[model samples]
Target: MKRQRAFFHTLRLPRFRRITLPLLLLLVFTATSYSLVGRQTATVPLPGLVMIDAGHGGYDPGVMSNGILEKDITLAIAKQLQAALQARGIPTAMTRDSDIDYADSGTKGSSSKRSDLNKRLELTEIQQATVFVSLHINNSTLATRGGAEVFYSEQNEGTAELAAAVQSELHKIPQMSKRDAKPGKYYLLRNQEIPSLIVECGYLNIADERARLNTADYQKKLAEAIANGLDSWLQKNK
Candidate 1:
């Protein structure tokens, strides 16, 4: 009885009351904020703002053939895509605006590669992007395989729709022809919690395709196609 009375007396004190009430309210607010963030992260079919990742940079040249480098093409396309999206008043973010990689510039081996990828992931989260599109050039043992291919992860529910929308637009490009969307196991796509897809602009192994990809006019066409596709998808989603 004495201890209970003492406890009640302490609560009645001005100092204790002032400190305790504020602390309790703060704890409640923090918990509520954390719960809301968790729910947002788990929700599917993200909408608003797109993220563009230009794959391979710095020491990584990616696929190289016939004096052409994959990294250059990827960056070119990504920049074009960013511009196209911005022109239409759509918000967008790019992983890289230059030839350098996100990883340490002078470091050796795969550590830098890993660091670069981790940075890209962090940016994607910070932006809270609706979808992630990684731009890259394709390569194969068979030189005959040419044309654009859009690949998406099955884990994200909206990725299939995103892939279809982009793929359909890519096909309209005279260079891309009628290539279809494919399922892929790419690290960026698989790890991304949002709707994600990879756009292989063209196969570098093919002679004519390589020549075309190297041209500024063809790159612009490719960018326009992807932009149109994104616009279509956004319309349907909205």
Candidate 2:
């Protein structure tokens, strides 16, 4: 019994734990480091970078109707879209991740908006992005219009195809009425340097549509649709 007690006491020594703890930590660290290194080496590079623009942030709340602000909705969708793309190993860059605009607050509102847009244009150029998607919610004095629409610049090559690809997936959403992708002369789209599109996710003027757009579940669906469209288009082009 004394021998057994002595052995058990030896097992409980502080020195034993100090030695064993370091060994255990070393083993864990080695395994984790190896796994991370393997993953980094194995991961494939994306076909190209994608630029995501969340429309009308900061001072520009965009189209506001009822209680819904278009800026909030666009930002929410843009965040989700960015996550969805990143999860698929695609690289993405965002113009504004927060409520603030890209331009200095001291500037006049019109100049601020222009400056914000110019900053976005600069980012697209600097990154040499393969394509740019701008998220927006539509509104009108007439409260009856509601649907997902994609707008592309006629001057930009492959924008029509990009718009069509995204619109097709968005149409799958039951709440969204099918609308054809159309030519738009919007400032964002008219940049012919790269393929660019403005996606009007839904009409905020319509009560039902506004409520749906405000929901997280619906925002996720919209993000997924956009991601799918982008993946399809990119794969085909590759």
Winning model by TM-score? 2
Cα lDDT listed for each candidate: 0.74, 0.74
Clashing residue pairs, backbone N/CA/C < 3 A, model 2: none
What's the residue-level lDDT of 67 in candidate 1?
Answer: 78
- The C-alpha local distance difference test score for the whole of candidate 1 amounts to 0.74
Q: Backbone clash tally for model 2?
A: 0
Clashes of each: 0, 0
- Model 1 spans > 4 angstroms off: 1-47, 104-108
Per-candidate TM-score against the hidden true structure: 0.77, 0.78
Cα error, residue 33 of model 1, in Å, equals 19
Per-residue C-alpha lDDT of model 1 across residues 12-56, encoded as one tens digit per residue: 111112346777676546542112222222222124577888888
